[model samples]
Target: MDITGERASESLMEDTTTEGSTMVIKMECTDDQPQMRENQEEVEKLKALLAQKEQENDLLREKIQTCQAPYPLTPETINNSSVPNYFRYCTGFTYDEFNKLCRFLRLPDSETVTQTHIPLNCDKLDRHTRHMPLRQEFLLVLIRLRQNFDLEELAFKFQIDIQSVSTLFSLWIDFMYDRLGVSVWPHRDIITKNMPDDYKAEFPTSFAILDCTEIKIEKPSSLLVQCEIYSNYKSTNTLKSLIVCDPRGSIMFASALYTGSTSDQEIFRECKIKDLLKGLLQCGYLKRGDGLMVDKGFLIEKDAKELGLKLNIPPFAKSSLRMPVSDVEITKKIAKHRVHVGRAIAKVKQFKIVSGRIPNSMLVNINEIWFVVCMLSNFQQHIIQT
Candidate 1:
């Protein structure tokens, strides 16, 4: 009975040991299953992240390719093409004429002209981006003047942003005005040399023909400014300038722009023409017998007489309904002489910026633009036949 009881106890101990080992193995398998699921989830997340990075890289490569693509309208392409074609298209000048103008201005070759030639406050310009060459800047100004293209259009044509176009246009306009404005007003001797024989025979003592020209502008927002620039003649808001031209239709002097409401007489006085006349007298460019042929608008007869300068204005019939034949003949002669000044004004207005209503944004540089246009007109073929 004792042996049988001992055998049963040993069998029960073996069975309990086997059940404990099985539970321990099952727990280890369950823990490993959860760890395997977590590792799979982690691997899926890594793959998703890698795919997203590759997509971004593809998009970046596409952008780089687009940026690197050559544009046909780029400055380099234009320069590489026939200079005559671009010169006439870009600047209204023939190749020979353009090169002659450059030589006259003491500028280097067009390729060598760069932004460094002009002084500018370039703090706002991006240093990382490549800058447009100087000749391109010059061409930009001419294009703006010749074509009157706005900033956006110019930006597209030049393959640059609008801000760069604006900056370049403004800086180059001021630079050109500073460099070329002085040449607009030449000495009286040069004017005399170029005077046409018709002018000499008709008005032997006349030095210059004086006139006023009006340029239409966008109406200002302010009521006072609107009133100040409103013109009765143009029936629109305008800016006015006093212009004097030699008989050869070369602009000798151009006054700073005045409000269109101002009269020719007011412009004459305010522009200090009397002082200019005084200087001319002192320099012997004008003597006692020298005259400034003017239209009736000038009304400076009394003031001019005080300075010993004759005011050759056409006779106005204050009371008569009709003038005598002699007076009519005199009016015809005066009108004929005055045509040269009108032609000079027309040449300056060929730059469409001044020909059309100027935008208010451009008002700040209007005077400078006016000076540039007038000065550039002198470089063109003379208005009157020599």
Candidate 2:
């Protein structure tokens, strides 16, 4: 093939000659222009086909890489990092906080690790070993709670199955609740020492700020269950939890989830926070005059009196919607100081799992999840300044 896109077939011949004798030579050239053109096209088609096969091979390699888990989390990978806040990126815990949690939730015993696999959120019990590292298991739980990743998403990321993800979360959440929940009830000294100046000046003896925070939950199929949990105030099905904060705005208490239909005052009475207050007073964590800061709707003045504690509640005007100037000022002061409680609740809600409307299946462990988030919130920086 030449520049003219034609092939030239040349025939050469030489006349026989003795040594040192000159020889006569003849040359003939034949060009099959059309056949050469067809051969050129065929060669080009072969080249294109080769390139296409190479590209297909490259794509096959990429798909293979995608199928394998190259970087399932390991402690060495997290700790040997060059970047700051890498731990926080993975599990929303600073390095110090992560280490602190490691200290608190020490590696569970074999009994703690052996969770019942039947009838959880998964189908079959995968007794076959998929040995995820303990820290990675902890990280998986945090990621699910903090980021609210579904079972499939977590299973893929951590190189496990959906059943393992469910079982691990249930096991770890309950373990965390048991370990951390017991000590979350604030000590009298912690609250008093951390109380802010505003509380000191306005309500100096304030024991705690009380409020009912509601978490939206899936509507149950059973109408009776629905009726039990439906909340007129939230205008949806929800579970109510009593979250109390000290004056400094750290969560002092987070009660278990109750029916949304439960009144705030009813929750207040039944949750036995007042009983704890009595114990605190008996233990000298509180004095008789140290009262709970609450909204007017929290009608437990009689209970407070029975426990020998005062109620720093706002006055209600019967005849008119106006109150005396002193009464209004007192109410304003209570409202102003109670803002930290709302901020404390907001901190707990930052964990989107408990903050958002939870699935119906989660109702079983919702209390533990809520308690864990509340307990974890206390480990973060203060919700209010001293």
Candidate 3:
């Protein structure tokens, strides 16, 4: 121990004799070593922190993509993974029928078929966001009677712009109506081909059951337009349509749409549903006592008699000298049997597509839409019965 102490004292003494001091050298070495180690450790920690933040940011971005707009999640629920499934896809109609109808209408298809430089703007959205073809989930909801939804619920379901839903509906109404309307009306050839065998035995002259229903319309901007559409029954602005149903309440014919201001008789005259009936009669496609049962509003006794078509009208008070009591009683029975028409109308409006006040943009398409709904009702009822 004594020798070691003597050596350390000599070494200290020798270093002290040099130009620079040993204590100064020792202090500089100690300061630089700790600082360099701390800086390296800090840089590694900063890189880890930056990587963690980057990962968190990527996670946040994905959540934002699926988040509901204008219905921000609370802080507690932001990271929760148990969101409800709401958005529905279109799969109601049979694939065969849907594709056939699309082809029939000449609508463009995104599947397996490409056209070069087609000059049409039929696609509702552009390619960047067009992961799926234009889908009407709202209409499918109605057609399928999906119970878990309402208009507001669907606004979040599809991640679609709300106003865009309304626009899409109007456009679809036009497309469907135009396609099905013509088919519903009985062509002379079709009427001959599908005539009931028993019609010749009982009522050989019966063509179709005619009735009217008022669909509510949004109040017009002008008072004149308001007065024109206002119906006395509902005491609201409504558009009236004439539906001519077959015996089972399937609408076989529909009048062209007219302003609510037009009287039922006037609409008949102007739009030529009556003229078409007369033409059918002239061609022997329709015969008289071919029982024409109409509501009291259309009390055209002479025309019915001249057309060789038997008119069944309800009993009016003695003061109104239009038709005999016998005719009224016969009409009453026909009306009773025809109440199914009202029931058919009720079934049709149950579809929310037609239940609401239709958009003004779709007014032109209403007639065709009416026919399509009727056909669907008939098709559904047939399916149910069979």
Candidate 4:
């Protein structure tokens, strides 16, 4: 009995040792649980951050691809492909003619031209890298005027963003107007020398063809502005200018833009054509008998007489059903000659930007744009022959 009791005590001791060891292991696991959880949480956070960074990297790569040139061009490509395409699509000049005009206008090559040379007052150039060469930029502006392409369309063609296209257009328009607009008007002696034979024979003293041309514009949101710009003749909102051309249909003078509500007679008066004529006459550039060929809308005969100028106007119906046959014949003859003024206006309108209704966004520069378009028209072949 004593032996059995001793064996039972030893087994109990072994059981106690095993239970104590298991308790120690459980305590250790409890102590490590919070640290393990923190480690797991940190791993999850790092994984999430890695995924986010990877996504950002992918976006940056895509942007880089988009910014790459869509149509790469070397000098050969520019001369061979781009020049001809631009000539046909926008400038209406042959490659050689375009180059000549660029030279005459003092336009610098895109590669060499500094950003400071662009005439816009805004900081648009700071927004993006200059992806286009200056030559391409010049062509882009000319094409925009010639075709009146939407900004998006021009962006796609030029492989640039729309904002860049718009900025380039604005800057180039300003440049062209500043550089070339003043050159459009030649001296009165030049006009006399370039007079067509038909004009010289029929009206030897005719100095210029006088007319008011209208360019339709976006309807204004303000009722007052709409009323002021609305034209009864065109039945649309418009801006009007007094365009004077030599007998050969070359524009010699373009007045400041006026509200369409202004009458042709009023535009002539407000534009100070009389003052300009007076100056020319006093300078001995024009003779006292030198005259302006005009349509009936110009009722400045009295003003012309006071200025020592003649108004070659067609006969008016005043209150009669018809005029004398001689007056009718004279009207026909005046109309025949005056038709060239309309043709000259058409040449200016060939630039669809002027021919079509101008967007309100563009109204701020409409005067300059109008002047530039008229000047550019002179770069084309003569609208009339001698």
Candidate 5:
């Protein structure tokens, strides 16, 4: 009996020891699994953070490239090159027109706060010195008209600071874009008078012509913006502006500011040009059979069809080299009629503000300048017609 009892006790002790060992193993295994899961989660989080940083870095790199790129016309290059004279002729500004503009702008002999204690009606805004030499001010104005001046050359030729030239430019451009921007389409009464007699008698269905022009800008620091602003034609950084012209070729409409990167199709949508066109239509001015001529880039065929309006485009020539006889004939006739819009575009570009490459500035006030120029163009055209 004693021997049997001892054997059973020893078996019971062994079973307890086995249970203890199993509990320790299970606890260790559970703890290890949680640690492994935690490590994996940490690794995933680090990867996400890394990707985010890379994206930010890419954006920053693009920004840097846009800002640091060199402008085409340095002061030295402009003084030496024939480009300035070419610009003057293309822009249609004679010495007389230049002087007249100076007088109109109140540029020459406008009392500067620094020159005298004379407080004119004008108050200073940024506390930046508005006291520039009259020549410098004139040069700056000319820049707005001729946009191709060598800032460095102007500084050297006129003996003024380049920064002053740049500051005046930025300020004036802002003024032009914001304050002087004209409507995309004039009121019905205004356009009705100018409609061609034949068209008024017959179809009475003509409205406006639309086109886009590229303006160069200084390189941006951002690579993305740089890539965006770089146009194939200019082979430089540029912004695209959309202009709408009346039958007389006077700009009835101009768009708000857009980056150089914007495409014509995107700009049309972004600027809501359709809204302006609709306004003219709703006013009962533009009829179903009315027509507009546009370059291929406008991509407005669908809209024209829906509106029951005719669009005149020179048919794409079969051979890239020679235009079809029908296409040539139509193009020549259209060009003659569309001369007013061309002239208007030419006048707007005359304001040095629209002439050359502009800097990638966030605060360009182009709308006001656009309006003022339109008003001027209207005034000038009437004078010429008379």
Candidate 6:
């Protein structure tokens, strides 16, 4: 104990020595090591937190930009996997038929639908966004035509405004018309090859069954417009057009929409369907004996002979006590075939856009709308089986 006390006394007495100074320095470094480690750990945690917050903020900002657009392109439900399966009920086309329509129109895939675009007629819908796919827009237009949904209904369903709907309807109709408007009259040999026995037995060399259909329209406000569009026969304002279909009820040609008061013969003259027939005959689309059928109302018998095509119109009855048996049989036969053209037109009218009273808003683009409806009718089950 005496020796230990003597050593401690000596150690204190030498506190200013170099060895004691080194010992003090080592102790101080050990004390600071823990604090430095703790600070480094805290700095790493703070960096991780800041990185996480930055990612969240970036995502939030992107979504906000989408919401702030005037005409948001994001579809509410129609363009995504959540869309319903009742597409046919809404747009008058099944998925398969819609796909076929895309292929037929040469429209782009939904992934890159903006490849070929129609110029917007107005600035309201000019801000194209990724909200709605082009395929969905096509369906919207078809649904409007098929179901006759009001603008409000379309807007709520499509998440767009009424003006957008009107503009889209107008633009898409023209786009479809531009692609599908080409005449497709089949050749004589092609017709004969597909001729059903019913037609073969009656009229072997027939080309088309021609008729005129009138679609009622809203009464115009201007007296001059009213006078031009009022149909004396239908006793209403309407639009008329010539529709030509093959024996199988496939529409071959359609004229532009004319004033409802226009005569069938006038449309036939103006539509150039007669000229087309002449060209077809000259180009061997019709053989020497090939003829087209028409209702007796068309006064083109003289023109038919000049064009080197026969007319199988029903015979007219003279002012006699009763019709002859031959004329009656002929009328019966012609009437049976004529029913197809009427059925084709009726099927087109079933679309309701052209079937119901057409509003004046559609008057300017009525011709293209009419053609689109008529063309879509070909997608249905064939009206005449054979």
Which candidate gets the maximum TM-score versus the true structure? Answer: 6
Task: Write down the lDDT of every candidate, Cα atoms only.
Answer: 0.78, 0.76, 0.57, 0.78, 0.60, 0.79
Q: Which stretches of candidate 1 lie over 4 Å from their true place?
A: 1-89, 110-113, 128-131
Lowest lDDT sum, 10 consecutive residues, model 5, at 113-122
Mind giving the per-residue lDDT tens digits that candidate 2 earns over 100-167?
A: 77667775423123223222222333533233345567778888888899999988877777887888
Clashes of 3: 6
Over 264-301, each residue of candidate 4 has an lDDT whose tens digit, in order, gives: 88888888777878877887777787778999888899
When 2 and 4 are scored with lDDT, the better candidate is 4
Error in Å for residue 245 of model 1: 0.6
Whole-model alpha-carbon lDDT for candidate 6 = 0.79
Tell me the lDDT of model 2 at 11. Answer: 18
Instruction: Output the better candidate (2/4) by TM-score.
Output: 4
- Relative to the true structure, candidate 1 reaches a TM of 0.76
lDDT (Cα, tens digit) per residue for candidate 1, span 1-386: 69999999999999999999999999999989989999999999999999999999988865554445322353455556765577566666555665566666555564533345557556645431134444455667777897799889987876777888787778777877887766344466766777788778877788889999999999888999999999999999999999998888888889999998999989998998789888878877777768889988889998888899888898888585777788888788889989889999998887888898898888898999998898888777777766
In model 3, the runs with Cα more than 4 Å from the true position are 1-124, 128-155, 162-167, 187-204, 282-284, 303-308, 315-332, 358-368, 382-386
RMSD list, candidates in order: 7.5, 15.9, 11.6, 7.5, 21.6, 10.0
lDDT by residue (tens digit), candidate 3, 55-164: 99987765554232222221123223254322212222333444444565565554322212132233664332222233232233233332324445555554555554
Which wins on TM-score, candidate 4 or candidate 5?
4
Give the TM-score ranking, best first.
6, 1, 4, 2, 3, 5
Model 5 agreement with the true structure over 30-112: per-residue lDDT tens digits: 88998999999999999999999999998876555333322333223334566655424433444445446546544444323
Best by lDDT: 6
